[model samples]
Target: MSDIATFARVKRPVVSTWRRRHPDFPAAVSANSGRPLFDGAQVTDWLIATGLGNAAPQELRSELALFGIIALRNRFTPWQLVETLGSLLCLRRLDGRPLADDGANASPTSPPDAEADEALWSALLRRAERIDAEDDFVLRELRAIDATAAPLARLAEDLVESAYDERGAYEWLLAARSRLGLDSLAADAVTPELRSLLTQLTDLGVRLERGESLTLADPHVRVGDLLAALLDDAEDRDRVTVLAADPDDRLTRITRRRFLLAGVSELDLDVQTGSDLEERFADPYLAGPDGPAPSSD
Candidate 1:
C-alpha cells in the first residue's frame, strides 16, 4: 500500500481511501506479515485507466490512443482489466486453444515469457480474431490494450492456470466486480448464507416440478452472476436452460459466456441484447418464433 502511495504520488491514507471507497480498485494479491501486496500490473492498469494517480497523461497513454486524460483527468473509466481478461477467458474457452504457444500447450498454468510483448500480443489477438470473428467477446478489448497487453495477457494466462478451467476463471474474475467497478452487476451478490438459501429455494422448486427441467430467466442479466450463483454446483445443469437479457450489450455477451462456459449448451441458452429486444428479435426459449408455448423464465 505504501509502495502504491509512493508511485501514485499520494499520501498513504489516500491509497487506503481509494481501496475503501472504490469498488473497482485492484485487490491485494497476497500478504506479507499482514501488509497486503497487490499485483503491480493490475494496479498500474487501474491507475492508468482511471487516471487516479499523479502520473501524467503521457505516462499513462496507450500506444493506440490516449485514454481521455487531458479533459477528464480524474475521470473513472468503466473499462477494467478484469473485464478485458474476462473476455479473453471467454475467447479461450470458445476456441479451446491456448492463448499462447510458448509452453501453454504443455502447461495450462505456467505460460512462458520467452516471446516479445508485441509478438505475444499479436499471436494471442490473432487467435482471438480467429475464434471471435464477429467481435462478440474479445477482439475489441484485446486490441484496445496494445500497450498493456504484455502484463494483462500474462495475467490472463495466470488466471486460467490458477483457476483450473474457463468457468472457474470467469467466476473468479467476476468475484472482483467491486474492485472492477461493476458493482451494479452484483445487485444480488448477497451473503454466503443468503446464496445458500437461494440455492435451497431453487432446489425446492425443482423438486416440486417432479424432476422436470428449469428455464431460469433474467430480464436484465448483468454478467449472469445471480443466476450463476444459484446454479453453482447444481447437478441439474444439463437439464437447466437459461433465457437471459440485458440492455447492456457487453454485459449480455459476458452473461452468455458465463453460462456457456459453465456447461450450458448453446441450444439451452438464449441471451438478447438491447438491440435484440428493440427489434423484437428475442424468442424466450428460442424453440421457435414464438418461444415456449405459454411458458418463459
Candidate 2:
C-alpha cells in the first residue's frame, strides 16, 4: 500500500478509495507476515487503464526499477545498491555496453531463459570484482551484495537501460532514495539554487580567465555540478582543467562519471576521494609550495 501510494504520489487513503471504488482493480498477489503484497506490474497496468498514467513510460520504468532495488535492501544494504547502480551507469556512459555480457553474441538467435540470467549475473560479478579490486570502498560494498542470496544483479540489469543518461539517472536515483525512506543517500545532493550559484560562479571564472588557460578545482565535488557548469560556460574548454575531490568514494566516482558524460576528456580531469581540506592544501594542483597559489574564491 505504501509503495503504491509513493509511486502514485497520493495518500494511503486515496489508494484505499481506489480499491473500494474501482471494480476492475487488481487484488493482492501474496502476503508477507500477515501484510498483503500487490503485484507492481498489475497495479501499474490498472493505473494506466484507469486514466492515471500521468507518468511518462520512462519515468514508470525508472520507478519500477527502483522498486526492484528497494526490495533487495533487506538482503543488501541501500549503499550497496547505490554503488552497484552507480557503477553500472558509469560503465554504460563510458561505453555502449551492459554491465554483463551474457555471451548472447555467441548465439544471437538463442532464446532468453534462466541460463542466460545466471550467465549475466556471473559476468556482472566478475566485472564488479575488477572494479572493487581497484577501489577499497567499492570492493567492500560489492562483497556485501555478493554475500546476499538475493539476485541483486537483476536490479542493475533492470536499471541500466532506463538510466542511459547520467544526469537524469542521478536525479532519479535521488528521488528513489527519498521514496524508499533512504534520504541519507542524497544528503549531499546539490539544490537548484546552489546549482544556479555554481553556474554563475563558473561563468565569472571563465570570463576572468579570458584567453589564458584556467585550472578550476572543487574540493567538495558533489556530483561534479561545479565542474560541469564551468565546462559548459568555458569558451576555451580545451585549455580548462578540473581538479575535484570529495570524501565520499561513491560520490567521487559519480562525479567522475558525470564529468565524462558532460564531454570532459579524461586528460582534463583529476577526481579523487579524500578530505577536502587536506586535498586543497596538500595537492600540488590546488596548493603547494612549488605549485601555483590557491585562489580564495
Candidate 3:
C-alpha cells in the first residue's frame, strides 16, 4: 500500500480511501504471514482505469520493480537480497547466458513449468558460482522460493532496457531500499548532485594530466560512484586505470557488477573489498611510478 501511495504521489490515507470506496479495486493475490501482497500488474491496471496513471512510464516501471524487490525481501534477508540481485545483474552482464541455454527461454512469456524452473535454477547456481561462490547461498534461497524467477526476470529485463544506465540502476536500487524500509547500509550511497560534482572533478583531473594516461583510485568506494564518474568522462578509456576498495562485500560485488554492465573492460579495473584505510595506504596503484602519491583533492 505504501509503495502504491508513493507511486501515485498521494498520502497513504488516499490509497486506503480508494481501496475502501472502489468496488473494482484489485484484491491481494497472496500474503506473507498476515500481510497481503497485491499483484503489481493488477494494481497498475487499477491505476490506469481510475484516471490516476499520470506517472511517467519510467517512474511506473521503477515503482513496479521496487515492489517486486520488496516482495523478494519478505522471504530473504537483506544481505541475501542484495547478493541475489547483484548476481542477477552480473548474469545479465554476461549476456544472459546463465538464465537459459539460448538466453531467451527463461522469461515472463514462458508459463511456469517444474522442469524449466529446475533447469533455470541449476543454470543460475552454476553462473553465480562462477562469478562468486559466496553468492551461491543466496541463489539456493532464491530457488527454494516458488514464483521468484518470473517477476525478477521481468524486472531485470525492464531495467536492462530502461533509459537509466547501470549507475542509474544502482541509484534506483538504493532509493528503493530506502523507500521500502528495507534494512540496508545505503546511507553511504552518493547523491546525484555529488555524483555530478565528482564527475566534474574527474574531468578537471583528466585536464591536469595534460594528455597523459589518467589513473584514478577510490579507497572508500561506496558502490563505485566516484570510479564510475571518472570512467564515464574519460575520453581515452583504454588509458584509464581505476583502483577501488570498500569494506562491504555485497557493495563491492554490486559495484563490480555495475561496472561490468557499464561495459568497463576488466583490464582497466582493480576492485577489492577490505579495510579501506589499509588498501588506501598499501595499494601500489595509489602511487604513481614517480614514487609520489596523487593528491585526492
Candidate 3 lDDT: 0.59
| Selected candidate, larger TM-score, 2 vs 3 | 2
Runs with alpha carbons beyond 4 Å of true place in candidate 2: 103-118, 125-150, 163-167, 178-185, 200-216, 222-241, 248-250, 261-263, 276-297
Q: State each candidate's clash count.
A: 5, 0, 0
The per-residue C-alpha lDDT of model 1 at residue 213 equals 67
Error of 1 at 17 (Å): 26
1-297 per-residue lDDT for model 2 (tens digits): 877887777777888888898888889989989977887768877776676635655666667778867766675666666666666555545545654454323221123455665566456556656654565223444444432322444445455456655546654665566555557646745567866776675464555475655566777776665456556565456666667777887778767766655655667767878864333323332331233465544
Which residue pairs show backbone clashes in model 3? Answer: none
Every candidate's lDDT = 0.63, 0.60, 0.59
Top candidate when judged by TM-score against the true structure: 2
lDDT by residue (190-259, candidate 3, tens digit) is 6779768766655645563576655666667767665665566655565656666678866676676666
Better of 1 and 2 by lDDT: 1
Off by over 4 Å in 1: 1-78, 102-115, 186-188, 204-211, 275-297
Q: Which TM-score value belongs to model 2?
A: 0.68
Error of 1 at 58 (Å): 38
Model 1: per-residue Cα lDDT over 1-297, one tens digit each: 987786677899999999999999998889999999876557777898888978653333221011111111233244555556677777778878766663233222234454566677777777888887887667877777663345455455655665667787677666656645656765646578866866775573454346666666666566776677766846567777777777787788778778888878777777788633321333333232223442443
Better of 1 and 3 by TM-score: 3
